[model samples]
Target: MGRHETISRRQLVQVQDRFIAAWGQMGAAWGVSRTMAEVYALLYITAQPLNTDDVMDRLRISRGNASMSLRALAEWGLVSRAHKRGDRKEYFIAEQDVWALSRKVMRERLRREVLPLLATLHELRDATDNRTEQPAGAPLRLASDDEPAPADARKPVTAAEVRQLNDRIDSLLELVQTVDRLGERFVGSDGKGLRLAANMLSKII
Candidate 1:
C-alpha cells in the first residue's frame, strides 16, 4: 500500500496515543513539561496535515496552548507550516523524516545549551588565571640561593592547576569540534553515508 493508504483510522488513534505517552517521557528527559510533550506527540502522530484548530480540537486543548506548542515546535524544526491549495489559512505538518528531525533537535540543544556552558567555563578559567602574573605554587617559583627551601617542602601548584584546567578545556573543545563536524556530515550525506556514520557515532557516543 501507498503511504496514504497504509495509515488507517484505528492506526492513527493508536499511534496518537502511543506518541503522546512517548512524548511525555522524552519531554521529561529533555527538561520539558508533560503537557508540552503531549502537544508534540499530537503533532507527530497525525497522518493528515492539520491547522491550529485541528490540533486544538484533536487534543482538546485551548487555542492559546496550541499556539504556544506550535511555536515551540517550529523553533525546534520538528513541525513546519503548510499552505494548502486554495486555502487562505496555513496548516502544519510534522517532519516525516525522523533522522532529519533528530539532527535538528540535537543541533539546537548543543547550540543553545552546551556551547553557552562551554563559553562560560572558558571565561571563568580565564578570569581565574588573569589574576596572577606567575605560577602560584612554590614549585613554579625560582628558588633563592640565600633562602634555601627545605627539601620536605612541596612545590606550590597554582600554575600546574591552571595548566591542568586548560588541558581539560582543550579536550572538551576537541570533542565539541568533532560533534560539529559529524553534524555537518550528517546534514550533507546521503542515506548510505548517514547510516555508516550513524553506526560509527553510536559506538563513540
Candidate 2:
C-alpha cells in the first residue's frame, strides 16, 4: 500500500500511544515521576486538542488528578490551553517542537522551582555561618521561625561541618549558574549538545 493509504485511524492511535510512552520514558529520565510522565505523554499526543475530561477518560486518571497535572503542565509551558471558536470549556495542546519545548520547560523550572531553592540554600548557608561566628548573646533563627536557641546558650555548628555544607552549596550554586548560561545559549539557537550536557548534569543532581 502507498504511504497515505496505509495509515488507518487505529494505526494512528497506536502510533500516538507509542509516542506517548516514549515521551513518558524521557520524562522519567529527567526525574519526573511515572504518573507525571504519563500525564505529560498523553498531552504530547492528540493532534486535535483535548479537554480535561478527554484526558481523564483516555488516561483513566481521576478528575482531580487530571486537573492538578494539567495545571502543572501548563505551569511548565509544555501544555497550553487552546482558545477554540465558541468553546465554553478549557482545552489543552502540547508545544510539539522539541527544542522549543525544552527551552520553555527549562525557563519555567528555573524561575518557579530552581531559583527559589537556590536562594533558600544561600540563605540557610549564611544563617549557619552567622551562628558559628557571631559573638555571644546574639540569636540565630530561620526567617520562618522564632529563634530556637541563643548564641550563648547553644552549641555552634562545627567549623568542619559548616565548611563541608558550604562547599556543597557552593558547588550547587555554580551548577545552577552553568545551567542558566546554557539555557540562555539554547534559547538563542537549537543545540542538541546543550541538551545532552543538561542530561548529564541532571544525573549529578
Q: Estimate each model's TM-score.
A: 0.66, 0.63
Go through the candidates in order and give the C-alpha RMSD of each one to the true structure. Answer: 8.8, 6.2
Error of 1 at 88 (Å): 3.8
What tens-digit string does per-residue lDDT give for candidate 2 at 53-109? 888898788999888888888877788787778978899887787778777777766
List, in order, the clash count of every candidate structure: 3, 0
Put down candidate 1 lDDT per residue, 1-205, tens digits, no spaces: 6566667879878877887888878888886666667776776676567888887887888999888988888888878888988987778888777777767766677778767766765565565455466556524322346876678858676878878887887677778767766766665665455668768989999
The best candidate by TM-score is 1
- Candidate 1 segments whose C-alpha is farther than 4 A from its true place: 1-12, 32-36, 85-87, 129-157, 168-177, 184-194, 200-205
Which ranges of candidate 2 are over 4 A from the true structure? 1-5, 29-36, 124-169, 184-205
* Candidate 2 all-Cα RMSD: 6.2
Q: In order, what lDDT does every prediction score?
A: 0.73, 0.75
